[model samples]
Target: MKRILSAALTLPLLAAVGACGAYGSSAQPSGPQPRAAAATASAGALPTAPGSVTIGSADFPESELLAHLYADAMKARGVRTEIHADIGERAVSMAALKEGSIGAIPEYTGDLLAYLSSASTARTPQDIYARLRQAAGAQGLTVTAYAPAQDADTVTVTRATADTYHLSSIGDLKTVAHRLAFGAPAPTRTLPYGLPGLKSAYGVTFRQFVPLAPTGTITQNALRNNTVDAADIFSTDPFIPRYKLVSLKDPKHIFAAQNIVPLFRRDVLTQPMADACDAVSAKLTTTALAELDSQVANGASPDAVATTWLTATGLAH
Candidate 1:
């Protein structure tokens, strides 16, 4: 999926048939607390148990970064950590969490809520987090502190049309949508993040809707070349700036906040490891994440990009 992001024409289709995790509510655990402040390392790193903590990530770059940070932080706490990245789709990832095949992974609050309850009401980030905490606790997962970075749903328009019509928000596109072409993943037309919600929320009926690849090299090029006037992009996509395009703000906030957050098994996150994970969350911001995504989209490896950002942010030394 990461490789598919680079080419517009070859973007893979998202499996939108069902929401994530079909497990029973009885599987959920009980009791969780807010993350604690980062404590100073007393002396040598904490002691590792006999077993290892498994960290998993979905196929996205940001998820991979969060997984790397979690693994590295656990290592700093004297825990043996293993990262299982690119672990298929979200449903599979959630099932792994339930079965305890992996200890931790990155997740979004809004997406979590929708997956858990299948609700359509767009809650604020705070509400979403609290709701997910209770829901995930029952599932035996703990959602640690949420990071400042948000890679939520976004829509973008070519610079040509944006500048020509003074368009800035999704609302602005309604006036000129008939003259525009929409390009995005085919799933976008059906998913809440795509055309269905787009039309319902913004009343944007475009001149055409074309299936393109993910929001990386391919969809970006289509937008840049005016082959598609608009595309479904992520808020953290690097090409938003590179292509000189404008992201139409969802003022109505139809899309929920998809902030980066660590989801770990309760047993894996000892006090020291929890604190380290919290520190990484505290320092990450949307702007910084976008820059990192740019580096990867520009051809740098995700591992290299994650390592560089971790070192620079003092999350790793």
Candidate 2:
């Protein structure tokens, strides 16, 4: 997976990514900020029954934007959709998926795999996607093709902090770990890719662990405000470079390669829906994804941004 680039998400993720696309980031569920698409032809969350089909996303702009991409693509195929946006934390959405509340969501290969199997040894994209498919299948889910784009979690520090500490790799923190505070999602305490793993793999033990929102923005903000010395910001989040944050290197490969993919309910994946997402996925490279994120951050609506991307890439007309 690292051969190309890196990974982010929104909650229990069963941490999604309490994974990201911050997947390269865990839970607390938020209520649905449902953004229902106008009724059209049918696809995406291809419901076998009568009710409206819903696509779910974690509480971050990237995830929401991903949901919009799926919706917009499906719309082009004739299916309208309701986005169960901001479906808080990991557990709630995982439960929702199991119970049929949402049919699909954008996910990171590594993060989703990590969330399902913390003990897994899979690493490469092939291995990770294979593992993830198994894990998701057991839960009655189907994963669409993964996009080249990724948004892995990065142990980011402000340029000032990086300069002050002479840090570049995550292992560098070991020397000053005891003096600095770490900010991330609440579940970081237990997630293999978070504090405990960092400590075990890199011997990193921060002076404090601030439980920030799973939303990369909050944690990234805390890093900027000096509320926390280092935070887990998504690799593709435009704010990283904008803020001049330094993403510490992971020499030990603590974080897995987290490529973006579609995680969906098996029953909801019609051929048209799957084909539409796969078409878009084929075009979603890391650089393309970062630009899409930048657009939303600059105030473009997720739907608008997604539509623009689809049209530009000729995935949609």
Whole-model Cα lDDT of every candidate shown, in order:
0.63, 0.68
User: Which candidate gets the maximum lDDT versus the true structure?
Assistant: 2
Model 1 per-residue lDDT tens digits across residues 1-317: 22233222112222111111001000011233234321212222333453467888787555676688767765666667888987866788888987889887877767776777665464456667777776666666667777766666566776677789888677788888899888877766787646776688889788898997464667677877779887776666666656566666666655666667787766566666666777877777666776776676566776788778777777766
- lDDT against true structure, model 2: 0.68
Per-residue error for 297 in candidate 1, Å, reads 3.6
Candidate 2 lDDT over residue span 1-317, tens digit each = 21111223322111111222222222101232111111112224445333235899876677888888877787677665789888865566778888998988878777678777878897555567767777877777768777766677568888898889898778888999899998876777787778888899999999999988665567666877889998776667676656666777665566776777878777776656766777777777655777788888777888899988888877777
- lDDT, candidate 1, at 253: 59
For model 2 the TM-score comes to: 0.67
